[model samples]
Target: MHGHYRETAECPGQTRGESSGGTHLQMHGHYRETAECPGQTRGESSGGTRLQMHGHYRETAECPGQTRGESSGGTRLQIHGHYRETAECPGQTRGEREGRVVDGLTSKYMDTIERLQSVQARLEVKAQTLERESNECRVQTEECQQQLRKCQSELNRQVKQSSCVIQEKVPFNDTKTSDYNSLNVPPHNKRHQLKARDVAGQALGFVQDIVVALLNFHSYTEQRVHIYPLDSSIEPISPLNQKFSQYLHENAAYVRPLEEGLVQLHQSITEDTVTVLETVGKLKDFAEHFTSYTHFLQKILPYQLKSLEEECRAPLCTSSLISKNQELQSGMKRITSVFDKLHRYIILLALPSVRQDAMPQSSSSAVFTQLAACLHSLHDAIKEMSKHYSQKAGLEQQLPTVTQKLCTTNECLLASLGMLTNSTDKIATFFSNNLDFFTSSTGYGPRGGVGVLNPLQAESMLGNKKKASDYMQAIRKPRAESVPYREALLNRRVLTSSTESRQGLTQQVVASQEKIARLEQEKEHWLLETQLGRVRLEKESQRIQDLETQLSSALEGGGGSPASALSLGLGSPALTSLDDGELEERGVEKDAMINTSLVGMLTTTPTNEEVRDEESREQLIKTHYMARVGELTTQLQVSDSKAVNFHAECRALAKRLALAEKSRETLTEEVKLANQNITRLQDELATTKRSYKEQLSMMSDHLCSMNETLSKQREEIDILKLSGKGNSKLLKKGR
Candidate 1:
């Protein structure tokens, strides 16, 4: 045992493999402590540097006291990716005459293989480092490319501005025929005029680009105003608060004063809390309600939501599913509306709004339960479908991008989550463990990507998904553009890209000078700010002195004096921003207030040294020069444009005069034709008058004839009358 050395590197790695066994034996032959391996295979440690091996776990055993102590991590060894288990050490290891039992050829071959493997490993390590560097370079390259893009955009903008300037300087009529004009315009003016027109189109596009950027900036500010607040729960005039107070007022039919809104809010909160608790307290068990529709929560609701499945199972159709989800959302809204009031006291994590919910007894647990059931059902469904939906099929259809939960770095869909999305919240609840990552929408699933479904917007979004193809539009369609970003604001992406732009380096000399001036002003402002802070600090010190005096007097007076004298009259320091020794003392004083008479005696405040700091800061911003620069640029552009207009106007006016003369000549001809038409019409009118008079005379002659005939008839009638009288006499005689 004293003359033997055995190689065992079984924990995970090996250096030189079995090939160097012969070499090892030759080297240790003279050393009495070296022992030949029973298997005639062992390698000298490869520079004694540990190498990590990645492969299936393999075991090789070495007896105690036989090893030279070169071991991986266990009493085992492997050679050339081959594992072999050795028995307990042979008792005759010392007596064994190793007369080259291992053939030199085989030993040499193994040694060669091991050397190659070692070389390969080193190469692999080198490759890994190279790959890491490559990735870093690639990232830097991408950043450079982005900066290049911004540079290009800015360059395009400058070109467009120059074009616009030239276009403005060279006046041209928009209505002028663009085909060809050789009247009064020379070729030089015409060439510039043509360039202006041609470049104006590109300028217009550049202007649109700038406008879009401005709009995006405007929206960014809007989002900051609405969402980027640490204390968002305390908005006095928030719409939700207004709605709460308004609802309270309407509920009791009382128009209370604005100052009492907080009192009203507290009353409402108390009433709602007590009502919800009482409603739940009366219930002996929640098992019955959990079961009534628990199955749907699992098997139907969430599955349909994730898939936007229209063809429902036996019990639920699309319409019923939609209606149920709407009802569920309504319940959730109510629950959130009630419990959301508690966020005022919750110091750690809280959403601006929770999108909370409830079930019968209206307990939040039921809401939570139903959400769990839906997710469990969805997950189970996924598992079942995963059985049938082959990986090959998934790859071919590109389904994982559309269906799998996002923000997971792992390749396999629905298999394992790399991390929880709500790790920031760190909240423990009934469903925290089992249901945290239940579904895509609820709990700790990816909520930010383009196709991510929000639990609050699930109903409308799913409905839209079923009926429409525009999922991004549907997901983003919220009341405020910022509404879609609210949860993201709370649960933001932890990893952020570094920002840089090429635009700064490309600024004009004026802009650079302006920036220099701005920095100088900022330096002055900071100096002034320090002075102001000193004044405020002095005022705080004065207030502290007064409080100390009041406290001392209170201690001296004891319980015998008035309550006013007993008051400690402590007021917190006004200058919280300063981090100097005095402010640290102030902070220490605040900490000291934690234990004593400092609590109740906080009424007194020193005279406020600054009331208009915000306004003062605004006034100090020195943007007038920047604006003046723009105005001067505009005026220069206008002045140049006016001079260009004089020349352009002369030619244009000359052309217009020619056109006007031609128009006037045409008008004279038209007037002559119109007069001829009028004279012809008058002659026709006279003929018509004469014809009318002739017809009237003819009609009168015909009337005279008609009168004479009537008279003749009258005379005949008289004759008849005389005959009738004779006839009547004859008739009387006959009678």
Candidate 2:
């Protein structure tokens, strides 16, 4: 068997030698044929020769044709000799040539397997790194979401608290009390009450005097008749008299209306005086109610809120709510103070008996002065009426026009007085609205509601309602010319107030938009970072897949032992050198045992068991890499999805923010325009007030001059009557 094995191995070697020599001879013959061809150039011949040499070198390197010590020329000669011997030997088999080809392919496959294993190891390390990074990114995302939720909750809480506070603070009622007690003035000392009563009595007396004077003037004017006859020589003799007669004729049409207006003025003043007296009586009761309400706010509401907060411990149980409650209390105190000042102003204006030494000049004083001016004008008109009836200075026509103007001025003053009284109604409304705050169980009051008005206080409230109704009725009544003026003023005020409200709303919208914008920007940044992380994870996954593909290719191509594949060129330089030494030693041993083992090594296709083992190991490695790649891919996909969701949310928030910003900008512009309108209205109001004051001053001056002229005329009439009486007695004696 040994002799047969040796012969078989020798036969294959001799066959390989013959095949290599025959191939070389064919190459040389082809080169010679190319060189000898008529169509072949020198460059083509040289190129063909070089190509043959390169092929020979590659063949020798892949499957050694001769010993390493042999020169190229000697090796060729030996190869030719061996080829002659191999052709004559006649014992070579085809299987031997196939085995040699398979061995060469297996060696090349081993190199590829080594490279694939190395790549696989690197991919695994990279995948592990990516996994760690992805985990970190996930943790960061979770943390960010947690923070966002916390911030949102906090903002909502703050908004709720602010809205609640604003609702509690805004007063919605408009009530005014003329009585000092109604304004919560302390009545412990009767001195203030006595003072108030004295002031009211004095104001009533003044109103009575004005009423009496107006009535007398009306009766006197109604009785006066100017009869124009051809008998009297009462012609306008001088230029001044002619001018006065012209004015009298021009203003004659106003006489009847002036008389009617004066009657209405007297009636209105009388009614206003009665209303004031009635309001005075209720002031003490209103004051007591207001005091109780303030006490409830300052003492009861806080205590209730504290108890509720202690019980609930909700988000509403914050210091800010307490602070707002305190602010409300302070505002109530301020309202009380303003009410007191207003009450004192009313007293000063109404009561001439009250000491005016300490009374500061204020709007009330201006109103009083204007009222006095109206009375003075009415007194001058009465004197002018008397002068007209006497037919002295031809001033009857002028008197009617001046009297009409005086009556109009008095009407304006009465309207102003009504407004002044109505102005105090705001204090009552403020008190009522504030008192209502305690009525709400969820707002400032306890479970058992407080701040409610008692039945005893209902009587005082009835007066307020009556007064308001009366005032409203008065307003509803038709005033021929004043209606348009009042409407214009009201429209202007409404425009200004609406503009102010719009501005406030705009500011709130702007602030909300800014908050939304900040949130959106933060969300966008987080999404961008997450997307980058996902991209990194995907890149790692792709690398892992690439490594897996290479590993699979190596496993398919290399049918070598797994140990050889794993250990081949995949270590530190020292380890690689040691592996090289071992491989060389194994090669020497294999060469020495070639005669015995060549057939076994070459003819033995890897045993099914070994092949299966290698394939399974390769599969295991591939599966491991693929599993890692899959895990990374899954992580990438999950991260990508998360990033996508975050991006979508960010985009939505951005859109909302942009809308809010646009709204805020529009509102801001509106606010600016509203402010401008308000300024313009204020300027107009100031101008009107100034012009009215000037007209009043000019009329007052004219009234003083008219009063002086009437006194002189009355003296002249008395002098003329005494002289006529003396002349009549003498004439009687003469008769």
Candidate 3:
């Protein structure tokens, strides 16, 4: 077994041919040894050798050159086939065959091993190619994913940028619109009016832009915005323009009424204040007069008192007691009179001043003058009282001492009234200052400019314009020759309000009347419309009743079909719900009955009694038909007239069109001619210019030529003269 393993191990490392050769060599060696042996001479030795070789060959064929030890190791089993045939082994046919068999087995085994190795190599190469392909696919997939990510990011960025752009532009456009809406100031000055017109145009442009943007937006909100007309004012402000609308809404309450009321109140109060100032002036006058009267009375009093004393010393004061009593009584009367007059004067002074201060400015002039006159009268009365008081004072010295008391009361009352006037003046001054403040704040600038009487001045100008127009109208009147100009002027006064107070009242009345008239006109218009509507409704109702009667008759007759019934029921509201079958039967019956009734009615028409009735009915029907025909004829006539007029108008229009066309043609021809003329003129002008330039150049050349010729001639002349002189000198020399 060890020798077999060594032989198999060597056989595995060596080619089959080499191993077979070695086996032949071994067999040959064995045969040589055996041939030399005694067993070779004997037949027993040959049989044993042959059997042994045969066994070995069978084993080699079975295991394919595998020895026992080589099989046990089982790792280095690779071999190639090697054939052996033999002359070296003389009696070794079995060994040689065994070697051939082993060689065939080994060759078969080697072929299988080579095939398996080739399959393994092919599989490994396929796996390597698959791995490389898979890796490349993965890299490409990763690259595609990166590109997708980059595209997604760029798309997102563009989306965000587009959204931002839309947002910015949308708000900017809305803000511009809001600015326009807020600043809808009135146009006063020419520049402002132009600016306002420009703003309106700009606003329209913005609106158009907004409309376009909304269309582009393609959103529900934008679609809804478009449902309303762009020019519609009723829509609420857009989100972007809300700020200005909100501002207008929030501040509207604060501004409008207060400003208007303040203006009106300022004008009213200023007038009142002016009245108060005039009243104060009146009071001042009264007070001055009162003071003067008091002085005059003081000077006149003594003389009047002495005269009273002298008069009292008559027969009525004969006895000493009677005369003295009478004197005392007379003195008391005088003092009482003086006191009464002084009290009356003081009261009058106080009241006139108070009234003057309280009177309305418009009435102030009259009131002031009246108060002044009353004060003057009171002053005279006070002078009379002072005279009586002075007389009483003289009498008091003689009889009683009470006159001085009366004089003191008069002085106190006069002084008190004087103080009252001073107070009024102060009050007037305060009011005047307040009026100035008020005028500046509310009455001037916006309402009327600059001065207190600006409104009045404007009114007066308007009045003058009216008067001038009236005067012109009067002068233009053919019959005005009978009416004096002054009379006409006087009559014109009636057309205007006489007083400021009356004028204001009349203005309010006129305004109220105008409002009432407008309302009445609207009411009358509505009433007329209502009446017309009612008349149409009544006519419709009557026609409906007649139709209903006819429908009822048809339904009752019940002969004809529902369609006929329905035809009879035309204009009838009463038979609206009649079903088809019922209506049909009713219509048939109604048609038959109507036909018979018409026949009977016609039968009566041929008889004398019926003839009259038939004639009247025929006349009525004929009249109605004639009236209808007349109406139709009138309508036809009207239509024909209209057509004629229209035809004439069309002819006129055609004439005008022809004229316009002719004008246009003329204008076109003129324009063409003008263009031709312009071209011709341009060409002529150019040619003339060229010609002029050529002529100028030619003239210049001619002048230059002439100048050159003249110079040459002069040079020739000089040369000739020189030559002559030289020749003469030569001649002289020769001589």
Query: Which ten residues in a row are the worst by lDDT in model 2?
Result: 223-232
Write model 3 residue lDDT over 330-403, tens digit each, in one string.
Answer: 54345334434543443443343343223323343444344334434433433343344444334434533234
**Model 1: per-residue lDDT, tens digit, 4-46?**
1223333223334432552343344323222333433234332
Query: Highest lDDT: which candidate?
Result: 3
Candidate 3 structure, TM-score to reference: 0.17
Clashes of each: 12, 11, 17
For model 1, the stretches where C-alpha displacement exceeds 4 angstroms are 1-644, 727-735
Q: Could you give the candidate ranking by lDDT, starting with the highest?
A: 3, 2, 1
* Residue 478 shift from truth in candidate 1, angstroms: 95
**Per-model TM values vs. the true structure:** 0.13, 0.18, 0.17
RMSD of each: 58.1, 69.8, 60.0
Backbone collision tally, model 3:
17
